[model samples]
Target: MADDKYYTLAEGCPFANNASAVLMRGKQGSGLGLLQDTQLIETLAHFSRERIPERVVHAKAVGSYGEFEATRDCSDFTSASFLNKVGKKTPVLQRVSTVGPESGSADTSRDVHGWAMKFYTDEGNQDFVFNNTPVFFIRDPLKFPSLNRSHKRHPQTHLPDANMFWDFHVGNPEGIHQLLILFSDRGTPKSVRYMHSYSGHTYKFTKPDGSFKYAKIHVKTQQGVENLSSQEATRIAGEDPDFMIRDMFEAIERGEYPTWNIYVQLMSPEEAENYKWNIFDMTKVWSHTEFPLQQIGRLTMNRNPQNYFADIEQAAFSPSTMVPGIAASADPVLQARLFAYPDAARYRLGVNYQQLPTNAAKAQVYCPFQRDGAMRFDDNYGGDPNYVGSWIKPTKFYQDAKGIRASALALHTDHEKWVGEVSAYTSEITDDDFVQPAALWEVLGRVSGQQDRVIENLVGSLTGVKYPELRRAVYSLFGRVNNNLGFMLQERTEAVIKTVQN
Candidate 1:
């Protein structure tokens, strides 16, 4: 007999009958099934092992399938094949996230947002793991753990403590530039589409001839920047914690795709040597006037991920993953992340995490030397030599004379510098640190009530600090930002504290 409907099991098997549908029971209406019950055991086993570990940071993120089209020729800067010709479209998956907060936290939190993108090109995967802001908190690699710890919940309380966050910020005054931007409305972006992504770390874009240019990337949304007020963000956090994610998904679903104009600010090696601000400093911004952005491409998120778990959650991106032309700079933070991100991914996923569908590269990856790890799904370079120095097989590298010369030139650098005392990394507030914040404070005054709101916000958080010394140090840091501003926080915070005490 023919089947009325498509005959199928949960796994799409053409099952003729689902036998043993009736539950076997004893006289008292209670029974224990034997090992014969295969379906129940199979279902439970599959469900138990479905999830992989979520990312420690950028855990709550939304991703979409898109295309990055080169809008202008940039052959002079880099030889990246994706950017070789104008109008070249490369498939891209972009994920935007709120850092620090867990996967379940509100999307509208006032925090640094992660803007990571993975480009699937013919060459390989080029991951642009960046931030929404153009600068970051700390520059030193050693301070990374401490910086993340400060942003995270306190160990003892296990609660989001403002004191820990502020104390770290005050102590690490190199973060002043980023701190000013973070507390501003930019932190509370109304939607992902309205936000901009910045390659805060300087990267090297090399030519086929081994010549390279230091380039900073910027992605300005065509949607234009939009922000949420503190009150709006608070209300939205309560009403709809997943507001940003839902907004992005629905917008794409409705065919209202968001696009960003991608541009790069380039600096020659010669100019980098004499640049006023340390090019490697994550806290400092490269002057736009000095190195203006040259339009290179446009990125548009046209489709959302079909399955969040498969496409978004399992996706891995690392700054260390680069194509031939793109390379990392000597920026300490970038150097740290080059190692840290991949290490974290391996821990969160597995040692063979790159074998996963979302993280796998499209380009020809011939790394037989890196074969045979746990969960290695690939052929394991079948019958091939896994180690180096094999007489039977030889390794081939497509290196030109220029590449070899460049390697020699790099090794010849006489960059001798004194190594000082190594201690836990920290930044003491100085005059140079306050110069930017003071300017930002004046700029805030131009926006009606913004300056007052900033001061009020500063005072509210400052009063919560438990240590008197730390509190005074914070005030001193702000005092350097602006003496009047410091006095205001001191006076206002004291009054508020006294009221609470009474």
Candidate 2:
């Protein structure tokens, strides 16, 4: 093969034909000028056109090659080919990134970390686009753009604005649950491998008979969840911007592969209907006490990327990427992301993005209808009829046979109406919204000084609010979760502001 011997162009043309510019020989043997340099022109042109668009979110990332092995049999609830049998191993490409930061931004920023992994199962690809936090800021998909923009710079100042951050959250108090966690010590994770990942949206695990159970996946780091304090995070951001990335790379290089145990909190369809909290809400979590975790699999990241751009940069993941027996829930954010992620990939990586090696499925794909986009390298299904229901060339639909099987009554009740109810459900913020945050606060209290650290972390940012009224509103927001906690926040925040002014 040409690959084993020497270098070649994108076409199989050998590179020895044109290593340097074709030129007239000078006295000192320094080639004078280029007369014919097709390879030179090609190399320069390819280099110029090499860079594609960066991701809108999670631009700065470090990826690894891993494997997920099923530890338990889940065929009773899910018929997914990856999970049906015990000890089944599926190859995975995982990427960990920080949101709201540019590619050049510091890795230790106090921002939400994106946890994305692609599983190459026999059925197809299953992409889990998850986050470090179990809950999100809002359940409404429409507020997504505004919510992200607010976390970014101000329009006029072109700088991170505290007022803008507080304003957005105060206006949409529905995000309070996420905001509380965001301002806590958990916001600044020490390393990507040290932090846990959670699927904020509930998904479904369906059996062949269309019987299904709601599932929320949690990947707990075997290294254990560890975070840097506010001071430590700030210091690391300045000293080593790529601290987290470098740590992960070195760990793999040193043969210290990190692993996470994947568990799922599952609820039956009847239990979901009777549950106190809406199962579809992205802002709330199913309590551990109510729905305990059941172990499913384990993931170990043993290999680092050989080429960053090809392995990590070109990789695209979406919650919509599902195999048989695995499906998305009606969570508005998850539903929106199901469309938004692939749409962004199409815009950035071309319509044939899925054909890219990093994003391609290991399983055989026979879709003739989706063809002829830019950068398409396939043979366009080899003269098969693109139109469906063709008598001339009878096309086989392999996908239909792999999807969830159903009985007559199961199709109408759980399959049809359940989807309708989940999609039509609307979420609102009430006093009940504070329930989880209150529980979280109690959990922090058990750690003894953890709550104090969270208050201190929050006050440091809250005190930077330029407007007094804005600061008060922020205090009131926290106070609603706990009366004494709110009072402490106001007192400490005011004291910090006064000292800074003096």
lDDT of 1: 0.82
Estimate TM-scores for all models. Answer: 0.89, 0.90
Each candidate: RMSD: 4.5, 3.9
Looking at candidate 1, what is the lDDT of residue 29? 85
- Give lDDT tens digits, candidate 2, residues 19-115: 6676788788887666366677778889999988999888898799989999999988887879877899999999999988888889898898999
Candidate 2 off by > 4 Å: 1-36, 390-414, 418-427
Task: Return the top candidate by lDDT.
Answer: 2
Candidate 2 has which clashing residue pairs, if any? none
Top TM-score model: 2
lDDT (0 to 1) per candidate: 0.82, 0.87
